[model samples]
Target: MTAPRSAAPERSVVDRTLSILGAFDKDNRTLTLSDISRRSGLPVATVHRIVNKLHGWGALERCADGGYSIGLRLWETAVLAPRSSALAAAAQPHLVALHGQTSLATTLAIRDGGESICLSFVSNDADAVACYGGPGRRLPLHATAVGLVLLAHAGDLVQKEVCSGPLRPYTRHTITSGTLLKRCLAKVGREGHAVVHGALSEGRGGFAVPVRDGRGVVVAAVGVVGAVDVIRPARLAPQVRAVADAVSRCLRADRPRVAEVGA
Candidate 1:
């Protein structure tokens, strides 16, 4: 038989390592070398060698049963991502306090290349939550309170890109049409906040507000999520606003101030 055309050149070691790292995503937080090799489409030997290197570098940790997971050290490095951490650090205490009172799930998210990534998610009972995307996960931006808020205020180019693409419908309640999305975005811009119901997941309602930096431009978004029946804005709005306002103050505080001589 004629020799089968060889597959494209084997991926480089560097590319394979990156693929291994990316293989551990939200749904699959842990995996074995075999899993990594399969997911990365690299030779098992190559995966083993690189995984060892990553482990030595503290980027990956070995599981008890011999699988691997993202290490805490890696998490520490990721926390330095200003898009996620700088804002989360300022917004966390407020999120914690909010969760304490309402026992709901809350998170801090930032727009990332047309996606929304959750930096922190506070929930006493995450398993019980009907919320989509756990902590340290990325979600599609087409149907989320945080996404709408960020997309609504984003530069015209980003807004146009998001509105022009194929929109997804998560549930019966999701807003899909570009025109409707535009209107919603406009409303969010005018309102300075967004309250969305069951747009991301069934029975899951969320509200989000932009957290601005010194120049008054939004750098990140913060929000809370809970069941539809339990998401009463009359009860939650004040707290959310208070928390969001505090976060904004922090962003403003980080700006350099002119020295005043009062002596």
Candidate 2:
């Protein structure tokens, strides 16, 4: 026909630049030029040019080992995102109070597509379930208490996508069955909070409650994590719910008002 329509059009400069940046993640923090090329599906020469420009602009940094990594400038820009920054600011004080009261790690997370991303984490024990409690960490939607609360409030599309199958099992207790996971979400909806025990990590547990926005839409989840024996859902659920409520109120007050039609 028309020369097979050239398969696909050439990627734009912006698309290439974004692909180069997207190649780096929590696991692949540093990569060589070839590594970027392979990960981004761009030619080595093209990657070299784009990487050089990003390095010059301080969006990428060169390691002593001659590898590339995301730069501090990107982080500086990322913190300005109102979604995470505003939520973190509103939840920090309450999270601190919760941590102080329970002597457990506290966290704030938001759902991004099918995963939960931790925005704020308050904990003295650096090694206590770092994967789940560390800020900027991504977790499965079916595993953690914070994740379950967010998933419970998430739209049906996300639910269907996650429950469609291939659920990863983190531990013996992780809910790998889509049927069981759906039931758990339904229970969380009725209870207004989630108490997960040994799901992500053995001997660890979590408690979470949903944070709603001004329009009463669930926007985030705040929670506490500790040893399974120490979680005590009966005692902690109310406290977690209280902090969530406080954050929701703050979000409602901070929302911009639309002026009256004729005012």
Candidate 3:
């Protein structure tokens, strides 16, 4: 684990604020003060003080059940994040184009620690169970194509961090061993894209390609999950690359891009 760095000055306040936000994750989107203390490793007293401040600032909201969750104000502010709103807006037309042509499930994701966070999803077929992932959902970086592509492009430190298990598996096909996962990421780096078979969900296949800025930094990953047999690179590659190209053009033209997931 990365040694928890000592929070610096007002950054501590920032960190505390983030801790409060971080308290609400995939499994626990609403948490009580005790839950926050346990999850954040903060003292209950510390959580009390910070939660008071966050609630006052409208960054968090208290539920009728006496739990806390991310506030409307936070959601509104996050909409301003380029990857969430701007990039997503630009990519929507392209995604719609792909969705019409493929009649499959398409997703856009960005790197978050050792995971890929879904920013947007467009699907032509709702029957597929994997199409159920909502925006803001997080999945392990080593398990999905977007995660692998993003991890392939990330720094070595990030690579090592992801490679280190405690790697969680969602299915039998998940790459759990560090050595094998390392090899898989290396292949993704060399290949420039990745195809993951049932790593995130069964009966689904995910393929991803990186969307880069003009300077060549990967801004996001364009991906799709579809019926396991239909996710062939030959079929999906062009659309993924095409959407990525469009997003890149927007970034170069400085128009805007949505939900550009960062490492």
Candidate 4:
């Protein structure tokens, strides 16, 4: 009998290209060529050639420190993703109304993997220091009010993963303890909203409510942030919930169009 032929050795250009892109993620946004070589498991010479090509095409950018980071071109392309783009577009009017009514910083965010990614933010407070570099920035699941709301509805697996944490404390009040975070998440679920004080930043209080889709699945969180003393959860909850509900309504109304366009 003839011996079975062995499978050909793998050397895919697509796989190699993807490996380079995969080397950059949340914790490792910028990487030196050596880092990419190690992470991609490719030779330095191969990494060098690929990196140059990617940089030329605006898929990667060279940092001042001679490292590489995802380029703005990639971000600009990412925002056009149908789901997030549609959600943001549908929620924009409600967000604007909320900001106009509250005169505080309001944000819209969706849970992306382990973190909450801000999609839209509006603030008239000139003195308000930016956090996480503003919209498209990622915030910790255990810190912000929006994060709490998102985590509350993100299903048991995500909750357990987050609660089993080396949770970083952004401020003294941030819930680093898994047990404490679990209790807070329970409260958020029961109340249909989340309120956090000085957790993500000093002297900043936040309130958030869930924004659901047509199927009633929680898709995002809408939140407002202001001074600790000024944040009356009782008053803010109603406003936040109202705006979030309005956003949900808009999304549901436009769902058919969204599906058609995507199709």
Candidate 5:
């Protein structure tokens, strides 16, 4: 009998390229060529060719220490993503106003799969800001106020998948049980907001309200993070809701014009 052929490569060029990009994260911001190869599970030679192309195209930057990091060009391209850009633009003024009013670290985030991706963050306290993470950072759906709000409003499949267990615990207070998470999400849905204390970080709390679109679909979340004592759910919930409502209105107003153009 003829020799059986080896299995074909499972990933396409696009998949490999995206994998290389995805290899960089908050903890692994800068990586050597070998590091990329290992993280992406591609051969060093393959990584070398793709990394060179990506570097030349400004998607990746070569460092002085012979490491690679995501380039500003990638950020420029990413910010232009319609959902994030439009949401940021409409919510920027409101985010600023909220920060000015409360002097707390505020954030806007949207759900991507089971995680929440921060679109905008405003704060003066570096430590406070770091607790919530900067823009583009992925946060757990069950561990953050904005994340809980988003998860509560997400589709049933998405909610079920996230609550299926293996939920990461950022702190002792972080909800890790599937049954408990479902209960929490149900409460968030009924309340229309989420207030989490020391869930993602000890000694800190988060408050978030859902942002709806024209059809009243929850599309995003906005919230603030501060010391546990400073985050009074009763006091901050209404303020956060007001900002969310304003952003929803702005999104609703813009959607009609886009529809007209598409029409």
Candidate 6:
């Protein structure tokens, strides 16, 4: 016997709202109302209603084709998030200068939960592999130099969790062995930086250093990427470290002032 649609429990306002927003991602950038309904598994009427509200609030924008995409308002809100915003602001100038001098791709990233999200990037090389992607793109936490440095500083729990198993291989050089990866991460911790060669792509190489917060926490990573032959980690380590240090100082100087109890 088929159950009546009316017999199903109604979704909460929060759940329905989140569903509509969650329907958009890097792969699914824009979608029609029908597409949102299908992806969110909500009734069309519910999707329409929620989407209209979202559009009005500037959380979503209606396209000329009557499709919906994430709005600039939403982006503005996201960039204000303290975790990435403060770090990105501090790192931007350094990243730009590095990119200008080296003519290689320089990227700033922060660990978002389990993934590394690119916050800023500058590159002039058309032939350089897009392993890091651009700003707002997510990269694996175990494949590149930035990822390795982040994982190394992310403490034992994160290292164990990521290295336990199921590490996807992007190339033959990608470290699939949890044991070997653990060793590599240990070395990264000792060196205070990471250098990866052909790990994310067949010919790509990278060098990364940690960006510390006001409290001395490893809040982000800055790195440079290019072809394996020309990207020498040891040679570039000093420059990358200098930039990372400059950003760290900025973070400390620009951080919010704590209130005094008796003031």
Per residue, candidate 5 scores C-alpha lDDT tens digits across 1-263 of 99987799578999999999989998899999999999999999999999999999999999999999999899999887777888989998999999999989999998888888898999999897666778888888899999999889888888898899699888899999999999999999898889999999999988999888887778889999989899998889778889999998999888832211101
Error of 5 at 32 (Å): 1.6
TM-score-sorted candidate list, best first:
5, 6, 2, 1, 3, 4
Per residue, candidate 4 scores C-alpha lDDT tens digits across 223-250 of: 9988888788888878888999888888
**C-alpha-based local distance difference test score of model 1:** 0.78
Top TM-score prediction, candidate number: 5
Cα lDDT for residue 67, model 3? 93
TM-score of candidate 3 versus the correct structure, residues matched by position: 0.79
What's the number of clashes in each of the models?
0, 0, 9, 0, 0, 0
What is candidate 3's local distance difference test score? 0.80
- Local distance difference test scores for all models: 0.78, 0.87, 0.80, 0.84, 0.88, 0.84
- Model 2 whole-model lDDT (C-alpha atoms): 0.87
- Model 3, runs deviating above 4 Å: 1-17, 41-46, 82-85, 124-132, 255-263
Steric clash count of candidate 6: 0
Please identify model 2 stretches exceeding 4 Å from their true place: 1-10, 256-263
Give residue 103's error in model 1 in angstroms: 3.2
Off by over 4 Å in 5: 1-4, 7-10, 256-263
Residue-level lDDT tens digits of model 2 in 1-263: 54555768999999999999999877799999999999999999999999999999899999999999999888899988777888898999999999999999999998888889899989997667456646688899899999999899888878888888678989999999999999999999999899889999988999998888777778889999999999888999888889999998888888733111111
TM-score of 1: 0.87
- Judged by lDDT relative to the true structure, which candidate is superior, 1 or 4? 4
lDDT of 4 at 181: 94
User: lDDT tens digits, residues 108-192, model 1?
Assistant: 8777777787877888666524355665677767688888887887778787888887888889999888888899999998988
Off by over 4 Å in 4: 1-47, 61-73, 125-129, 256-263
Q: Which stretch of 10 consecutive residues in model 1 shows the poorest summed lDDT? A: 254-263
